[model samples]
Target: MPQADFYILPSADEDSRYQFLGKLATRAISAGHWLYIHTDSEHLAERISERLWQSSPESFLANSLPTEKLHAPILIGWQPDHIPNTPDMLVNLSTIFPSQTVEFSRIAEIVIQSDEILALTRGRFKEYQGAGIQPRMHDMRKRSS
Candidate 1:
């Protein structure tokens, strides 16, 4: 299962976006999924955790976390979105920061262009072809069946 995290653009209504995230958190809780909220602010993480803890002590998260995803810098990871978090969810949550989407996109583009090495090194995957890699998706399906 893949989990997703979306950081709100700072200038956009921070309060509303957080409220939406809280709702997602509540859903996560009910599903028993792990929520990893990566944020730059330690205090904000604690405050969010505290609020969630109040609603479902049984599923309350122990902490907020930091993320190292290259795309999202100030990421927070939390789990179990059973109770949608509201602005009042935290007493000491930090203010949102403006997103550097354009900057990050440019950097990613540059890196990907420079790393054409993946195409050059595809031969390395050829050895693993026997294990799983296939030349085409249809061929892989035939083998699995």
Candidate 2:
């Protein structure tokens, strides 16, 4: 079976990472697909599991998946672990247990749902390194020079 995993990221329209994960869980359960989410926050995990997955967080773990399908760990730009300390499990799973999941965030949907906001966010993200990282070289030059 194909492994399912993702770092659950907001599309830039949403503000909370938890919210992003919450929505993802909801969608996954709605689709009858299961996934395991790794995070340090137990409470947040529980609430999302209840609200979205409609199952216990443990169910999310039932049937583990290879992480590669997770694509690159979509670490939030700047929350706390912004330095990027991916664990060995995530790296190893990615190579073999490829996950075909999309870390849907409200931000991403917002960008697509609203045309005006989409334009503005695109401009902002272009400057950003990833999600919240500093602007890229061109944007930096545009600002400095």
In model 2, how large is the Cα lDDT of residue 38? 39
lDDT of 2: 0.32
State the lDDT at 51 in candidate 2: 42
Give the candidate number with the greatest TM-score. Answer: 1
TM-score of 2: 0.25
lDDT of each: 0.32, 0.32
Estimate TM-scores for all models.
Answer: 0.32, 0.25
Off by over 4 Å in 1: 1-11, 50-145
lDDT of 1 by residue, 4-104 (tens): 12222222344433454555566654564444343335566656555654535465433334432233112253322311232112111222211221112
Best by lDDT: 1
What value does the lDDT take at residue 50 in candidate 2? 43
- Please count the clashing residue pairs in each candidate, in the order shown: 27, 10
